[model samples]
Target: MRETAYWLINIACAIVILVLLGVHMGVMHLDAILARLVGTVPEPLAWENMVNRGKSTTQVVLYIVLLGTALFHGFYGLRTMLLEFFSSDRAARVITAGCVTAGGVLFVTGTAVTVVFALNGAG
Candidate 1:
């Protein structure tokens, strides 16, 4: 049951990653297309636009969410792959611990940076 829950969470994370990355690509990469469609800023990568996004609470939250979901999804998949190769209870425990720790650290750090940037007004 526990393993099933983890698997489901990992799948959900993948879906979140897909949706968030799609938004990211549309905003950051498809600048020309979006400009034509919506008369967006000439350069999505402009410093002014980046600063504006960084100062936006909604953008900060979305960035943190994307960071967390990507980290969790990647780490969980990696843990699964390593377990398949190791195939020992001890190895499984160690892999799980390492992945969890690393993922947690990355998530916290990313969230902090996002919050700080928003608080600082991205100047």
Candidate 2:
């Protein structure tokens, strides 16, 4: 049950991240730039307007979620692979646990950076 839940969550987060990246790129490049070129109103990129009007909040949250989920999934899955290849008669689970801990630390740091930007209204 728990493992299935994790897999489902991993897949969901990957899909969300992929969609968010696509939408963000499309807006910044296709929509926003085209709007500017056609409208020709003297203004900056107007990212603030993009955020205020467009679905910027979802993009920001999705970015963090994507990073966290990918880190956890990739590192833990890699650790599992390593366990299958190597390890003594024991210590397999221990090593995987260590990887999980390390991945958790990395994800926390990454998430903290994302939080700083989100809170400061950068992203």
Candidate 3:
């Protein structure tokens, strides 16, 4: 039952990652296409545009969410693979602990940076 729940959560995280990463790519990498289609700014990565986005609460929240979701999805996937390869209860425990700890640290750090950037208005 516990494993099942974890698997389900992992799957959900993957879906969230796909959506968030797609948005990130479109906004940061497809500036030309978006500008042509919707008359957006020609350079999404321009300093002014970046500062604007960094100052936006919505963008900050989305960035945090994306960071967390990506970390959870990646760490869970890595844990699954390590467990399968090791196939021991002790290995399972160690792998799970390591992944959880690393993921938590990364999430906290990323969230802190995002919040700080937002507060500083990307200046």
Candidate 4:
């Protein structure tokens, strides 16, 4: 059951990413098409309040999941890819560990910063 739950979370994460990818593509294409049609180029949207925006509750949840999953997936991928490509002995393992550790620190620090910003309404 636990394994299934974890698998589901992974699948959900992938699905979330896939959804974001599609949304991104659609927005890019739409922007270009709209620019041509409207004869006015739209400015790129900027995100303020890096922690808590006026976004929906669902968006907040998705943001957290996206942050966590992307960090884990990308970092782990980099580590494994490096381990495969580099045939060095201690140096490679040390580098892999270092990469993972850096990724972990990034995730933790980022999350903490966002959480503080979120709770304090300073975002």
Best by lDDT: 1
Which of the two, 1 or 2, has more TM-score? 1
Q: Write the per-residue lDDT of candidate 2 for residues 1-123, one digit (tens) a residue.
A: 965876776677677767766766655557757576676432335767644432456756766777776786677577667877777646776776788798889888887876666666554
Q: Which stretches of candidate 1 lie over 4 Å from their true place?
A: none
Looking at model 2, residue 117 earns an lDDT score of 64
Better of 1 and 3 by lDDT: 1
lDDT of each: 0.88, 0.67, 0.87, 0.63
Task: Report the C-alpha displacement of residue 89, candidate 4, in angstroms.
Answer: 5.2
Clashes of 3: 0
Question: Model 2 Cα displacement at 8 (Å)?
Answer: 4.1
Model 4 C-alpha lDDT versus the unseen true structure: 0.63
Who wins the TM-score comparison? Answer: 1
Tens digits of per-residue lDDT, candidate 1, 12-112, equal: 99999999989889999988888899885557778888988998888988998899889988998899899999989999999999999999998998899
The parts of candidate 2 lying over 4 Å away from their true place are: 1-8, 28-56, 87-89, 121-123
Which is the better candidate, 2 or 3, if ranked by lDDT?
A: 3
Q: What's the true lDDT of residue 48 in model 2?
A: 70
lDDT of 3 by residue, 44-67 (tens): 868888888988999998989888
Better of 2 and 3 by TM-score: 3
Candidate 4 residue runs with Cα over 4 Å from true position? 1-13, 20-58
lDDT of 2 at 84: 78
